[model samples]
Every structure is written in structure tokens, then in C-alpha cells.
Target: MVKHGISLVEAARRLGVSQSTLYIALQKGQIPTFRRDGRTVVSSGALRDYQTGKRPPCAYRL
Candidate 1:
């Protein structure tokens, strides 16, 4: 997972969203992420999964 990890900012940029928005998605379990060096990071595969619709938004349904 280390090799596939990227900083949250970079991931946000790649996804064309703000860091805070991405962070919220991470916190909501809408995105796959893990802590690295005490900071949250996202995997390239996770990003791909998101783009491919393998991951879904976690907004409240009720």
C-alpha cells in the first residue's frame, strides 16, 4: 500500500476536488484511504476505482 499511496492534496488535485471535500469523503467511508506518516493518503487503485464507479458517494440517505 505504501508504494500506491499519494498525499491527500495530490489525490484531491487528481480528482479535481478540494482537499477538504476529499477529506470528508474519506471520513465518510466513500473513499478508500489509510494513514501514512500520521496523515491520510489515498491509493492509485482507489482513485481508479472511484472513477470507474466501483466506489459510491457516502452521503446520508435519510
Candidate 2:
């Protein structure tokens, strides 16, 4: 599996949600993310934090 990070599309795929829904959530600032190499990259760290109960509730359920 990809370990370092993932693109928004791939992240959505991994989360079993539609890519467009992920995009909409991102635009609404409802997901945790960051930028890398000029591309918006979802933070693996934040995903972990979310999994471990360290983040606010988000509706995506990813």
C-alpha cells in the first residue's frame, strides 16, 4: 500500500467514497489535508489521528 501520502482522488478511493464527494468535502474544509509538490495531498498523519480519535467529526466516514 502507499505509505507516505496520497492524492485526493486516491484518498477518496481508499475511503470507498466517490471522488466528487471527496472534492466537495475538501472545498468545504471538511477533510484534513496539506500540499505537496504544488499538489493538494491528504495527510496520512491526520488520517491516523482521525482513526485514533484525535480529530473532529467529519461526515465523509472515511
lDDT of 1 by residue, 1-62 (tens): 13558888899999999988887777777777877778778888898898787886676432
Q: List the residue pairs that clash in candidate 2.
A: none
Candidate RMSDs in Å, in order, are 2.9, 5.7
Candidate 2 local distance difference test against the native: 0.70
Q: Which stretches of candidate 2 lie over 4 Å from their true place?
A: 1-3, 48-62
Model 1 scores worst on lDDT over the 10 consecutive residues at: 53-62
Can you give the lDDT of residue 62 in candidate 1? Answer: 22
Model 1 accuracy (lDDT, Cα):
0.80
Listed in order, each prediction's TM-score against the native is 0.73, 0.62
**Model 1 stretches astray by more than 4 angstroms:** 56-62
lDDT of each: 0.80, 0.70
